[model samples]
Target: MPGNPALTEATYYILLSLHKPRHGYGIMQQTEELSGGRVRLAAGTLYGALNTLCDKGWIVLKTVDEDNRRKEYQLTDKGREILINEVKRLKELARNGEMILGEEL
Candidate 1:
């Protein structure tokens, strides 16, 4: 799968939150918790990110409630690949930063 170099921080967390299936609100809560409350995504921002991820084939609708009000999404195989690649890239970045700063992080 071709990787997206332009994936934003919000996009990364949003995708990561879907490692299991989750609805929009669930995603928001998990993202905040993951970031220690430093990355709270508003509903609109999250919905927009979800739409973009869906269009990119990175996430898919996994389930819907009987009332059709809650929909859960999960990562596709391609999404997992992308997430792994992003992790690698982030590690490289951290390594480089540590090297330049002369400190371990």
Candidate 2:
């Protein structure tokens, strides 16, 4: 949907974050925390990913109640599927790579 999202770890993290219905900054913080600082979603990148996922029908803006400043997002069924597929792909790649490398050494 988002043009070979198959190669994006950040995308997966973003999707995972929205699985719990979180705001933009909340999503960013959660994603970073979950990845142990290995991943940081910048404002630009986060919005871009959100829009892309929305266009692909994977995610949607659940609600917006900008008090001081905030908006939340939630994952659609399609989003869950996308995330699941990405995880499976990652596992397969890891298995294959590990086997080949271990055998060679």
User: TM-scores, in order shown?
Assistant: 0.88, 0.83
Q: Each candidate: what lDDT?
A: 0.88, 0.83
Q: Cα RMSD (Å) between model 2 and the true structure?
A: 3.0
lDDT digits (tens) for residues 62-83 of candidate 2: 6566575566789999889878
What is every candidate's alpha-carbon RMSD to the true fold?
Answer: 2.3, 3.0
lDDT of 1 at 92: 85
lDDT of 2 at 45: 88
lDDT of 1 by residue, 1-105 (tens): 465485688988998999989999999999999999999999998888899889989999866776776789999999999898899889888888989986545
In model 1, the runs with Cα more than 4 Å from the true position are 1-6
Distance from true location, Cα of 38 in model 1, Å: 0.7
Evaluate model 2: give its TM-score. Answer: 0.83
User: Candidate 2 at 13: error in angstroms?
Assistant: 0.8
Q: How does candidate 2 score on lDDT? A: 0.83
Residue 76 in candidate 2 has what lDDT?
93
C-alpha lDDT of residue 105 in model 2: 56
